[model samples]
Target chain A: DQQVKQNSPSLSVQEGRISILNCDYTNSMFDYFLWYKKYPAEGPTFLISISSIKDKNEDGRFTVFLNKSAKHLSLHIVPSQPGDSAVYFCAALGGSQGNLIFGKGTKLSVKP
Target chain B: DAGVTQSPTHLIKTRGQQVTLRCSPKSGHDTVSWYQQALGQGPQFIFQYYEEEERQRGNFPDRFSGHQFPNYSSELNVNALLLGDSALYLCASSYRTGNYGYTFGSGTRLTVV
Candidate 1:
């Protein structure tokens, strides 16, 4: 069974959109969550992360919200630009976690 | 400082052939991890090396093996490659103990026929 799941395979948004990507996880032991972005033929680059202690974390135009009771997390990118078009992956881990558990990813397309 | 560096940007091999991929970790990084990503799929952890030892592993088979040198550089080797082995191999570097920040390389594309 997949510990992390990104149900949406793709999402489209207009430039300057408030794009929101959602993720759900089955493992309750996950104490940390991170988002990574990847372009074609490239490795994933870290974007933002949130500890279980906090329900929300914001960084500039990006914000991440975690709902512990729902086992859901969402990444919001305000004023999305064309450069934001890429694959977004959700990763989760727990304390003493050896490796991260990653979802299938959601491909975001921001049009001009 | 250089992030992570992977060699042989792309390579092709046939079934039963073997392949070796190399990686140089970022400065001040002591741990190395390898991931495999198939098309339309997220990267999956293969294994990790720290202090020149295999510290953790994923659900991959024995065909996936790796080595971390004293300098913190690493190499991933695959023997008896199959067509299913074709994918993008990514190398990530992190600190041996502590924070979870990781730096990833561009990755090497391996195609097995």
Candidate 2:
């Protein structure tokens, strides 16, 4: 069973526009969420995270919003640039366990 | 300062063989976690080691085992390799402190024939 799901396999957006990626989780026990960006042949890099206690967290051009009631979360990148093109993964942490359940990943393409 | 580092960036093994992969965590990090990523899928947690002991493990089989040295480096051993064992093995390093994000290595791609 896939606890975390990224419905969209890929997304495309124009530069300077907002790019939104969505994710959902079936495990209600998950309380912490994180987003990671990965480039070709490279390891994933942490981008942003949001705790269940808060509904939203923002950093620079990236913002993450969580809706506990819906068991859904979304990542928004404003003024998307070509450099933002990569695979984005959504991860969730449950309880005190350090393991993170990840989504299949969404390939984001920012067109110049 | 360096990020997590893994050795033998690529390897190939035939069925019924054994393979050992190594990892060196970043400076001052005390915890190490291993993950197996199949093609077109997200990474699956294998296990984690801290303070020279295993603190957590995922739902992998006994064929997968690991050890952490006193220096915080780790080694993952897979016995009786199967064709399905072929995947990219990723090593992540993080402090034991709560809520800290893990830094992952480039990964070692293992191919089994």
TM-score of each: 0.97, 0.97
Chain A (alone) TM-scores for all candidate structures: 0.96, 0.97
In terms of docking quality, how is candidate 1 classified? Answer: medium
The residue-by-residue lDDT of candidate 1 on A1-112, one tens digit each, is 7889999999999999799999999988889999999998778999999999999999999999999999999999999999999999998863363577889999999999
- Candidate DockQ scores, in order: 0.66, 0.61
- Residues A1-112 of candidate 2 have per-residue lDDT tens digits of 9999999999999999999999999998888899999898888899999999999999999999999999999999998999999999998875354887789899999999
Query: Each candidate's lDDT (Cα)?
Result: 0.91, 0.92
Given candidate 2, what's the lDDT at residue A34? 94
The local lDDT score (0 to 100) that residue B28 gets in candidate 2 is 81
Q: In model 2, what lDDT does residue B21 have? A: 99
